[model samples]
Target: MDKIFESIEEWMRNLLTGMVSSNLTNMFTDVNEKTGDIASQVGQTPQGWSGSIFSLIQNLSDSVIVPIAGMIITFVLCYELISMLTEKNNMHDIDTWMFFKYFFKMWVAVWFVSNAFTITMAIFDVGQNVVNRAAGVINQQTAINIDSVVTSMETAMESMEVGELIILALETLLASLCLKVISVFITVILYGRMIEIYLYSSIGAIPFATMSNREWGQIGSNYLRGLFALAFQGFFIMVCVGIYSVLVANIQVSDNVHTALLSVMAYTVILCFSLMKTANFSKSIFNAH
Candidate 1:
């Protein structure tokens, strides 16, 4: 009877141990995959990230928005020319240089409207370059050392009673489920940012048309600042991931398996929160409304 009881206990222990190990393994895998993905996604320019969508947006912008921008540019230049002529002396003090200035401003306004897409893309290219450099620094360091986790976790599980191991197994399973939800949130942030970039780029010419007018230039200027904010928002996300990686790297799973797992989950939550805020933070810095 004692032999039978001992055998049953051993079987339960093994089952629970396997369950905990499997859960931990899956959780770590999710974290590492997300970390790697953020590095690559954040570094991609809009055109490089989704070429088909970007090409479609460009086509739409050229066909639809550019003509509207042309009319806006003409109206703004006419207003600007009138403003320039009248602002000096109500009509009597027109300098010869004023006409030259009006013509120069007209040329600039037309050029900006014509090449709005090019200018908008250039902003993202600069952001991509910055993020790529940061990515190289963080890519190798972000993966969780799951081997270390497995080694120490196995030894710790051996000393745990069957009932305790069962509870821990359930806990780890719950943690893993939480991680799956977090992963979805991360995916949303990445895809949503790309979609926003495409949307903003589509009407880029309209804002560029307003840039050369002294009275109305704030419209285009704020739009440009918003683009910069969107671009650098990716860089801020990379920084958040890099910080999370460093924090996770310092976690000594050998010290306490339960604490380490919970800490990892907590840090991942923090990472998601930080990534969500990057857009607003970047916009505030750029003063983009």
Candidate 2:
């Protein structure tokens, strides 16, 4: 029984050591991958189910929204033209320059609607470049070290029991699952937000066509504002991940076995909770509500 307890204690120490390393590695790796995904998704459409959705939204925009926009533009311009002429007594008293002014406004409005997509993408292109450069500079370039954890618990592990080992195993499994779930949840939000950006951008020309009107123009303005918000949201997420990694790396585990375990358990809970808060935190940072 003495030998068995000794083995169990040693195994538990190893298990706990492995858990700390794995969690840190997985967390940072996920952060790196997500930043890459967010950067690449800018200005570039996706493939697979997301691609299919983009295609449908784009087709509807081109086929319905754009044509309707063109018709609306024509109607609005004609009304403006006739109104201008009538307001000046059917051009009898018209300032010849007013004709040129009306024509110029028409030209500018048409040009804006025609190139709304290119313009919106330009915003993302600049954002992506900034994010890629910043993220390259900020990262957890190496795994976290919890040598203190093992050093402190080294002697105490010699008397660990089988029941304690079982609990340790269960804790490891739960921690791993929690990390994976957080990674998946965050990845989905980043990708889904990307898809939504494209979908909203598809009909961008519609609201843009009516941009001279305050009420109608709000749609296009809000779309661009929202795009900028989502774009910067990724940067804030990078900040969160980087901050979390630094904090985890600095954790000071005490020399007592129970104390070390308590510290690790608390850290795991805090890390998971912090990661889960990142979406809302990032959103708030960028005023992305």
Candidate 3:
């Protein structure tokens, strides 16, 4: 009877040990993959992410928005000329240099309207350059020490009884599922930002037309600021990931499995929430709204 009970206890311990180790390995693997995915996604520019969508946006801007922009430019130039004449003694004291200045402003307005897409893309190019450079450093800093974490986890599990190990295995499984859902949310946030950039690009010409006018230039100014905000929002996302990785990497699983697991889950939750706030934070810094 004593020998039989010993065998039973050994079997239960071994089974639970495998179960706990397997669950932890899977969880850490998912986290590492997700970190890599985020670094890749955040480094992409608007056009590189989906050329088809970019081409569609370009075509729509050229065919539909550019002509409307031309009309807006015409009206703005007329208003500018009228305001200029009115400001200078109601056109009675207008000099030759004043006419030249008006014509120069008109030429500049036309140039801005014609090259609207180029200007908008240049902003994103600079932003992408910054993000790409940051990605390398951020990726290195955000690497979770998966092997060490798993080894420590296994050692800790050796001290746990079968019942405790059973509970821990279940907890890890649940945490892994929660992480999968959080990964989906992270993807949504990244993709949604790109879609917003596309929408903003679609009507870019209209705002560029207004930029040369003194009174109406605020609209164009605000639009450009919003573009910068959107572009740099990726940088803020990368920062959040870096912070989350550091927090999770620092978790001490050998000391307490439950505490370590909960810390990881809490950090992931914080990351998602921080990601959602990045847009608002970027916009606030640039005063986009």
Candidate 4:
């Protein structure tokens, strides 16, 4: 027992030290320069390059491991939500049992996803598609000089045709709309996962909250039902994000002004709605008979 405690202490100390080192700008610069030199040298030989590339990938994974762990925690919460929904309700509910089952399933899913390189590759592929499509549009539409376009606009009073101005406006509008839609889709997927994790962690106490396992299960079930009720609320959030995106994109405000307004509106609306749902969910979880 003493050895185990000492090991844990040593592990925590090392983790904190590594985290502090990573936050230092000098450490990052050194790592970047070293990696660059190693990569350049490896580029000269296929055998050497493979080993160096593997090391580079391992280093990158080390840096991102914490964030990946957080994502796993979020997945666990989602599983708990599902588990709560499936269990049969009884007068003497065993919420702790359900929680244990949910957590086990969550762990299995996390392990499978982590081991499945194809899943990670598919996510990156989707990101690449979005980037490629956006770049293609920008290249096609903005091939000419922006200064020339502005100069033409300046002389519009005397020489500009209405059709040419309308065409330019439409093109810009189309590009902006395409980007906004893509942004909303990405936001929904990311935030949906975040909310799932948060709610699961928040409700995770039911297992330990009661003396009897049956009472714990009832609490877990109630929490799960509340999560289901919030599904519509989540959909509403996506709609709100879409509307907010369009409003910002179409507004003729300065970039800073547009960003400030959008940020304030989006955060305020989302935060308020999230809080409301959480409160209602908590009440339902605790008071449901």
- Candidate 3 has an lDDT of 0.89
Tens-place lDDT digits, model 1, residues 1-289 = 9999999999998888888889988887777777778878988988889889989999999999999999999899888888887888898998899888788888888999999999999999999999998888887767778878777788888888887787788888878998898889998999999999999999999999999987689999999999999999988998898898888778886677778778878988998899999999999999999
- Cα lDDT for residue 12, model 1? 90
The per-model lDDT (C-alpha) reads 0.88, 0.60, 0.89, 0.39
Better candidate number, 1 or 2, judged by lDDT = 1
| Global Cα RMSD, each model | 1.3, 5.0, 1.2, 24.1
User: Order of candidates by TM-score, top first?
Assistant: 3, 1, 2, 4
Give candidate 3 misplaced runs (Cα > 4 Å).
Answer: none
Ten residues in sequence with the least summed lDDT for candidate 3: 138-147
Per-residue C-alpha lDDT of model 3 across residues 1-289, encoded as one tens digit per residue: 9999999999988887887778888888888788778878877877899999999999999999999999999999999888999998877898999899989989988998898888898998888888887778877776777778878988888888888988998889888888899999999999999999999999999999998888899999999999999989988988888788888887889888999888878888998999999999999999999
Question: For residues 129-182, could you state the per-residue lDDT of candidate 2 as single tens digits?
Answer: 666665666543523544544444344444556566456545545555665676
Query: lDDT of model 3 at residue 262?
Result: 88
lDDT of 2: 0.60
Instruction: Give the Å error, residue 118, model 4.
Output: 21
Q: Specify the highest-TM-score model's number.
A: 3
TM-score of each: 0.96, 0.69, 0.97, 0.23
* lDDT score at residue 19, model 3, on the 0-100 scale: 78
Report RMSD for candidate 4: 24.1
